[model samples]
Structure formats: C-alpha cells, structure tokens
Target: MRIVIVDDDPLVRMGLKAILQSEEGWTVVAEAGDGSAAVAEVRRASPDVVLMDVRMPGMDGLEATRLIVDSGSPAKVLVLTTFEVDEYVFEAMRSGAAGFVLKRVPPPELIEAVRVVATGESLLFPASTRAVIERFSEAGGYELPDLTEREQDVLRELARGHSNQEIAGHLYVSVETVKSHVASILTKLGVRDRTQAVIVAYESGFVRPGDAAEL
Candidate 1:
C-alpha cells in the first residue's frame, strides 16, 4: 500500500517511515509536516492512505479531514491523536476520518489499524467505543430514531455490541425479527453500517458520549 505520513514531529514521521519500510506490501509515498501540506501531498501522490496527526499548527486534522473528504480525494485518513477524550474522538469521526489511533499505540497495532482502514473496515478500537459511549451518555438520554419501541430497543442493543442472536434473545424476538429491525434502523439513520450509525447517533446529539454505562 502507498501511504503518506503527516506530522509536525520529525521523529514520529521518521519512526513511522522506518516501521512501514520494514513491513512488506507497504511504502511511504510522501511525508508532510502540516495539514495543508498533507492535503497537497495527498493530491499529488494519490497515496492509498494518509497517516495524519490530529494536532497541527494550522488547519488542524479535523478541518483537513473535512477538506480531504469534500475534495473527493481517494486517500483514506487515519488520524493520530494523543487524547482519549470524547471530544477529539467524535470530532475525528465526524470530520470523515476513516479511523484513528493513539500516538502511544504499539507498532503492530498501528500497522494493523492502517491495514484495516486501507481495506475499508472502520476501526472500532476500544477507545473509539468508549468515545461513542461518552457521546451517548452526555445527550441527557438517547435520541429516539423513527422506529417502533422494539426497533429502538434493538438499536440500543446493537450500540451496546450485542449480536443479532443475543439481541433477539434479550428482546424475546426471533433472529429474523432482530435482523429486520437492524435493517430498519440503518435505513432510518441513513447509514451504511452499524458503525456509521453509531457515529451518526452521537453526531446528531441524540446520545451523549457519557450516556453509555454498558457496551
């Protein structure tokens, strides 16, 4: 995979380059020191993925992410952050980042995260789920979508990380019914998957990040 590294810290950029170089099937296409530079490199290099630092001197990662997505750039962004707070996590997701990892993450996990994102799977790291929970908890109460009571129940169960069978059993409904509800939930939320739906749920201010006590 062709990848670009973007960070103000030369040490971090160099370290990432070394690790990426050691991995097979990966190449460091370009490096940038700021968000604007990152965007320009993305347009020029057309790398498959961009490893971007969340905090930058100008055009922070969130704005840069918005610009990249809005520009229809093909490169997927993987934000690197130092914070575990809900604010940063939710902002990154809302800004159209494919995923993010803490800067202190192990080398192996970082490689896997980039690989997963490049392959188009949303990274739902434990920290990510915690951010989502905080988003829901702060909303006073969960935002109710346009669904029946049963459907809402299924969605909540889903946000809690329940499987279809588990949700069915919890609600005393059949597996098929749970599946149908999940489909309906996705439709009403206009999301492509449960992950995006979860993001939307928090972004819409319907669920506060702190509201999650379970899942």
Candidate 2:
C-alpha cells in the first residue's frame, strides 16, 4: 500500500514510518508536518491511505479531512490522535475520516489499523469511539434520511462494529451480499466509509449507544 505520513512531530513521523515501512508491501510515499502540507502532499502523492495527526500548528486534521473528502480524493484518512476520546477525532470522522487510533497503540495494532482503513473499512477502538460519538452527538437524535428496511438493518449491525462476515451470519445473507448492502448504505448516506455510517446510526437514533454497548 502507498501511504502518506502527516504529523507535526518529526519523531512521531519517523517512528510511524519505521514501523509501517517494515511491512514489505507498504511504501511511505510522502511526509507532511501539518495539515496544509498534508493536503498538498496527499494531492501530489495520491497515496492509498493517509495517517493524519489531529492537532497541528496551522490547519488541523479535522479541516484537512473535510477538504480531502470534499475534494473527492480517493485516499482514506486515518486520524492519529493522542487521546482516544478526543472530540477532534469525533469531528474528524464526521469530516469523512475512515477512523481514528490512539498514538500509543501497539505497533501491530497500528499497522493493522492502516491496513483496515486502506481497505476502506472503519477502525473503531470500540469503547473510546462510542464514548466520543455518544458524548458529542445530539441527545435527541436527528431524523434519519430515507433508508430501506434492509439497509437500516445492515447499518445497525455495522454500528455494533461487526465485520462483514459476522453481519452476514447475523442476517443470514452471503458475505458478498452484506458488502453490497454496505456499499449501498455508504452511497445512500452520502458518506465515505463505515465510520461515518456508524455516526449517522447513533445520531439518527437508529442505533442507541446501549444498543452497541457490547461491541
């Protein structure tokens, strides 16, 4: 996978590069020190995934993520944050980031996160992610846009952080069928990935935090 590393901290960038590049199939295509630079580098490199730091000197990752998504770039943004429960991370997700991960996560997990995001799957920390989204979303919930009954079912399972195969089992559908439904959900919701779909599920009250608590 081609990748871009974006962080204000030089040491953090170096460390992440070392770990990610250690994988034979991955390449660090570019590096940027802040959000604006990240945007420029991402546009230039067109990497498959961008490891973006949430807080930076000038433009923050939240806005950078928004710009990247709005600009129709295909690269997925996987936010890198120091705090798992950060509001910035939540906002970044709404801005169309694929997911967020704590900076202190183990090397193997972090690498797996990139792989997941690169594949267009959402990476949820499960506990902390629910906290951030629930804490920040409106309490009363927003009215859901028109979704088919099957799509709604697929989304509720998605909000629970189930893998495609697991959701397939629950719904008694083929894995490819679940994937088709997920793609349709993303398109209908006008969101980039599963992370944003989960946010919509919670905010729409289609799936309550307690409903997904087990995940």
Candidate 3:
C-alpha cells in the first residue's frame, strides 16, 4: 500500500514512516510537515492511505480530511491523535476519516491500523470506543435514530462489539436476519460501515456509554 505521513513533528513523522516501511507491501510515498503540504502531496502522489495528525499549522487534520473527501480523492485518511478521548476524533470520524490510531500506539498496532483502514474496514475497538463515547456522553445526550424494535436490539449488540454470528446467537435470530438488521442500522444511521454506525449510536444518544443494555 502507498502511504503518506503528515505531522508537524519531524520525529513523529519519521517514526511512523520507519514503522510502516518495515512492513512488506507498504511504502512511504511522501511526507508532509503540515496539513496543506499533506493535502498537496496527497493530490500529487495519490497515496492509498494518509496518516494525518489531528493538529497542524496551516490546516488541521479534520479540515484536511474534509477537503480530501470532499475533493473526491481515493486516499483514505487515518487520523493520528495524542488524546484518546478527544471528541474531535469523533468529528474526524464523521468527517470521513477511515479510522483513528492513537499516536502512542505500538509499532505493530500502527501497521495493522493502516492496513485495516486502507482495506476500507473501519476500525472501532471496544476499549477506545468506550472512552470516545463516554467523552461525548458526558457533554449531553445524543439523539437516537428512529429504529424498529429489532433494529434497536441489533444496535445494542453491535455497540457491544458483536459480529453477525454473535449477535444472531445472542438475539436468537438467523444470521441472515442479523445481517439485514445491521444493514438497516447502517442505512438509517447514514454511515458507511459498522464502526461509523457504532459511533452514531453513541454520539447521537442512541446508546450511552456503559449502558448495561448494550452489554
């Protein structure tokens, strides 16, 4: 996969580049010191994935992600941030970031994150997602989408990180039925994948952090 690293800190960019380069089939196509440079490099180089830092000088990663997606670029952005619980991460996800990996993540995890994101699989794990949800849930309640009874059950299971087979087992429904419900949930939430659907469930108040019902 062709990848670009964007960050104001040279050390961080270099560290990430080195880790990514060590992996087979991954190449560091370009590096940018700031958001504009990152955007320009992405346009010129057309890397498959962009490892973008959230804060930068000329433009923030959020705005850069917005521009990149708005411009119809094929490059999927994976936002990098220091604060794991920051609400802006949620905003970045909503703004079209394919995934997020904490800046301090281990080298192996970083490589994995990039690969998963590049393959278009949204990465929302239980531990990080709970922190993100609680951060927003503290501010105010998020609005839940209008969902049928079955859809609500599916959302609850999804929020708990249950796959289709698991949710089907838990809900005593057919796997096909669970799949249909998940698809309906995604469509009703207006999100691209399961990760984004879970984000909407928490951020929109469809589900609250530590809501035992979800567990």
Model 2 per-residue lDDT tens digits across residues 1-215:
99999999999999999999999899999999988999999999999999999899999888888898988999999999888677788899889988888899999999898988888654466567677787787646677778899988899888777788888989999999989999999898877789888898887878776787654
Q: Note the Cα lDDT for every prediction shown.
A: 0.74, 0.86, 0.79
- Tell me the TM-score of model 3: 0.79
Q: What are the per-residue Cα lDDT tens digits for candidate 1 across 1-215?
A: 99999999999999999987789989999999998998888989989889988788987777777788788887788888887664765676666776677889888988887887786533346446555445443433445567788876776675665567777888998988888888888888765455556666555665445544464
Error of 3 at 35 (Å): 1.4
Ranking by lDDT: 2, 3, 1
Write out the backbone clash pairs for model 2.
none
lDDT of 3 at 5: 95
Ranking according to TM-score, highest score first: 2, 3, 1
Question: Model 3, residue 148: what's the lDDT?
Answer: 97
RMSD of each: 4.5, 1.5, 3.2
Worst ten in a row by lDDT for model 2:
120-129
